[model samples]
Target: MNNYNHILAKSVENGATTLESHLESVADFAVVAARYAGMDTEVALQGALLHDIGKASVVFQKRLRSKPSPLELPFRHEIASLFFLKLVSPDLQPFMIDMIVAHHKSIYKDVSGTGIIDLENEYEEDILQFHLSDFSLWASEAIGILAELKFPGVTHETVITEEDAREAYYFALDHCRKRQKGWSQWKGLLMGADHIASAVGDFKEKVPALFADPDVSFYNRKGELYPLSLIDSDGTKKHTFVKAPTGAGKTDFLIKRCRGRIFYTLPFQASINAMYERILHDLGDHVEDIRLLHSISQLLIGEERITEKVIQDKFGASIKVLTPHQLASIAFGIRGYESVLFDLQGCDIILDEIHTYSDIMQAIVLKMIEVLNHVGCRIHVGTATIPSALEKEILEILGKEQVQYVQLSDEVLTLFNRHEIYKAEAFTDLLPVLQQAVEQEKKILIVCNRVANAQVIFEQIEELYPKTKKMLIHSRFKRGDRNRLEKELKNEYNVSPYACIVVATQVVEVSLDISFDLMITETAPIDALIQRFGRINRKRTAETIGKYKPIYIIAPPQKDPDCLPYNPKILRDSFKVLPDGGELLRETELQSLINQVYPKVEMLNIDLDAVFVDGKWRLKELWHLPKSALIEKLDIDSVVCITQEDDESGKYREADKEERILMEIPVRYSSLRWKRLKQLDIGAHPFVVPDIAYSSERGLDLAKTGAENYDTNYQIW
Candidate 1:
């Protein structure tokens, strides 16, 4: 007990500002996780408490040194924990240690092989390798803390030595490698033990009551009840066909069926925020029940603060709405994803906009559904249009021919008036058009295809109506600023007679709750256009507010040869990869567009890499080549800066646009490639030169090894 208290005291003393808080929260979260996974609570709680003891290791200390250390800081907490456990209990089962190690496994393989360029030579031979003894110190410290705390079953054996440390480190690494292949029996055993340990945390105890509120109703766009009875019915699970257009109360219908904890997977961040706002407005009392689970959400929303006590509460009946990436982390089993397991048990999920996901993404989502359903989750998915592949994947995964699907009734259609689309040849002179609307005191949303374009338009509008009220919104701007803008927009600051124009990018598309009287949008994908149309006249108010205004599509000038409306190459390539060949286009006017566009577009007949077979897209090395080649063929090289701070001169001068990096990448497909460059740092850019002109000090000269020296002007492909 004295030893345990010592460790606890030390942790509190040495812990960084958020370290203790993080530890407590994770411990509490672990308790709920354990119970949800059907484990005993006591062991889980203890494990969670000790998970970060590895922080006492020498490696961790080095991280806090005055000078920048060559050694990477923040060793894997799981590794540290596992090492610490072994030190105190030399005979501890290997499976128990495996759990700690495999907790936050990396799922994505770097196919580009250029993961953040390592100009600093981080992996160089001179760097010292991490030793096991360094890890044991953290483990030992943890044991002492537990002992001081007088926690039952907290006892220490013989002191740890260098040999024991080395063996444990090797064992852990091998175990982690094995886990990457697939969970082993040993892994199951560790998980079982960890589960038991976690159950001791408070989160395992009681389910929240918010989910059971009687006020919730599961209805479709038309206010009709969902067929809740279908869950137990013997008939085939008919795929729910949602014909309702966007903003027709589809989300409200989903909220009703999700009486327990809910997991809503949206297609985009905008949609997630929109849903969060809508949910907050309709069920303001349940705002606390809502857990916005997305990268953006984690950074921007929520002021309540995530504490150990809050995490201790079981996720039995709450709300967790996330983007596909956040949810993907769960399916792929990342560290944070384990919380999803705790949240999912006996939960209801709303998979909105089911058809928007790509085929590979759809495959993963279906697997997620299968796993969640197996763990006792009921899901309701809604989409403007349901594709056959998506429908088939969901059915196959759920092992049902049909799922409860309610269609929009003709009566509901009568309530939603038809929207008219006007095509404009040029928007260069849009200020006059908007000036008139501003004179009439109408709220208008001007949407552009790119941030740069949005900034240009906004600047023009501001000049045209310098004294008029206006604002610009996009993802690049700081999150707090956007939230503030949203608040002002909501209270009628942006739409009042005094408020004139709000310029925005695609971020305005989904999850934004605001409505505009008029919208001027650049040409984009059909689905995006439909989404834009939804922003206008949404509530069907009696004043005919939206009817008086016309929504304009600012079309680009017709090509010299009068090309097709859509990109023929993109359409044709999509068709070849599509499962039904071109048969899937039967429901829409896509075929004619495909025919018209293919003539002018390049590489229409190119085959996409086959990613799926036998109801799944098997992961392989070659599946990404076609996409890479396409970008290469298009001569799209992403702009990259070797320096930490970007130079703000010349073409790289800071743009007025929000979130605009100083480096102006002229290429259209740079963002895609930027994600692939690995090991990037603020080091000198390496130049590849022939062996004859090689210099050791300047930078890497790839030309010596028959690799081209990177040049900004050279084609990346």
Candidate 2:
């Protein structure tokens, strides 16, 4: 066998490539990333070059081949790698330790309770000797590789004793234990580079353009219909707050107002998908990189579908459209947060439709705002319905002096008086009107608050309007199914000259770009309801300005328990504040109505489990809390599932993201409790639901959930 293909001699690069090349690849990426982040490239190169050198040990080589190479005590490569700290400068050793020690394991309380500090306290002398076990035999080989590079601190013929390893471990421990309150850019840089290197072999060739601003002049075209576009976006303020009706051009105005690389955040995956497609279409020709940040974003939404799971969150995207959940790690200091924090620094983040989420979620979002501000990001908020109290709280955080509050003029607001509100006791009450609309060949939309409710209505509508084209969309469909639903919702039914009805849930509330002739929606919060109203008569041109469409809103659920995921009082107040009985729901009165519903922001104290609190970072530098810790504090129950029919457990294990994403479905963990289901031992432990519970038309049928397995006749494969 040739030297390059000699598999028996390989120890690093997962036993697939040479170790020397891997170190060089990581150094190339790290140096480039450090330059982009304005950090010292020399330190970054040295850190990257030495982080994985412990793999050169003969014990590690045997272990890679599944040979019995157990030591007297346990071994951690991160620990063994610390023995060669003499190869680094004293001034830069601290930075290198942060990069190497916790790149794979946590510094302090690793989930396995085996971090460097963990063993350091348990067996001080013994731990050092275990890492230095047979070190004399392999240290020369590791040193020879380093000496070949001829970098600054590569000392020749190093004869380090157990005492030297002990001293190095304590030095790193002391540095981390007595650290200050800022995130380490060096650690983040190394992590990003290493992740990029592992996922893509040629890091230099694969890393996209970094830290370049995208040209958003495409949104600068002024039109009479879009009132906000006519307003002056250039101002002395550093941040912005714009509250206008949905069709009043909030998205375009926000994009045009940005001065740096943009982080466009939305509330839902569907909204992000729509915004990504729109931005890419408008800006893809001019910008080299405009990405959508989500787990299954590539396969379901884009042309360049990424099959390999590379670290897509690295800085340098001209614009990235994502949801708040993707940025939650920074607020709680969860895994991979430092890299995300580094990416968001000094960018223009547009928080679009920031009015959803429960009280706890609101606190999380506010915490995100605090962190973004701390990192020097310019925050811009755009919304159709924002309560006075919430707006005031956001202003206080962003600082009233720094925010440019923009509102549409009264005349322009009056021009958006497109929805005429009607009161309904139940969905059954709208049957006569819905039938009339369908008979008149009008496009119709129906919105329910929950998936089950949407499915029930969709089945009923499907049976009643057998001749009319119909579809159902919500948060529960499989990735591929939802992609198809969204495409048909936007293109097929939405544009077909023939009449159609789309029954959906709250997914349609925010930035989903769709228009219907009329709508019948369930009652939600005033802010949410206003966003839903935007879907009706939404194409606001000169011709559509004066034209009015009808919307029927069912009254709020009477019982408080049934009004879960929303405040009962807020729901009642939102319903009461609105004009009913075929009255024109004037866009001018939306803010007042919203303020009446939400008189004050419900502030919750989450400082006990948060990274940022009272304008201070609780998480110390060089350390990050475990994902389990953050998951517990956040009380997040959402989980993923794959239908038994679409079961690709074999493919999913093989890292086929494109195929695996299509098989997966997003459902709440609580919803699957005490139920008979099969779980795959993967991230989030994806559950396998029986085929009887899902439909391509209406999504998962909760009523069909049972202790039944997939039938051979129904399985896709």
Q: Best-fitting candidate, measured by lDDT?
A: 2
Q: What is residue 173's positional error in candidate 1, in angstroms?
A: 7.0
lDDT of 1 by residue, 1-717 (tens): 332322221233343323333345455555555565566555555555555556555555555443444544324445555554553344443445544554433212323221111111333212213524444455556555555444356655435555555566556544433443222222232343343334333343442433332345423234222222222322343223343555555666556545555677787656786676666566656344555654344333444433212332234335666665554433443333444454555576678776554435555566667556655667677765554444555666555534655555545444444355565556865657677888888888888866667776776886788887788776543343455566666666534655467887776776466767778887654444556656766655546422433677665434522213334434334323322211221213432343333323221322232222233333321111112332233322233222212231322233322122222222223333332222222222211122322221111112222324323432241
Deviation in Å, model 1, residue 265 alpha carbon:
3.0
lDDT assessment of candidate 1: 0.47
Candidate 1 residue runs with Cα over 4 Å from true position: 1-28, 49-95, 104-143, 149-241, 294-317, 330-347, 354-377, 386-402, 428-436, 493-499, 541-549, 557-717
| lDDT at position 600, candidate 2 | 78
Q: TM-scores of the models, in the given order?
A: 0.63, 0.93
Clashes of each: 51, 0
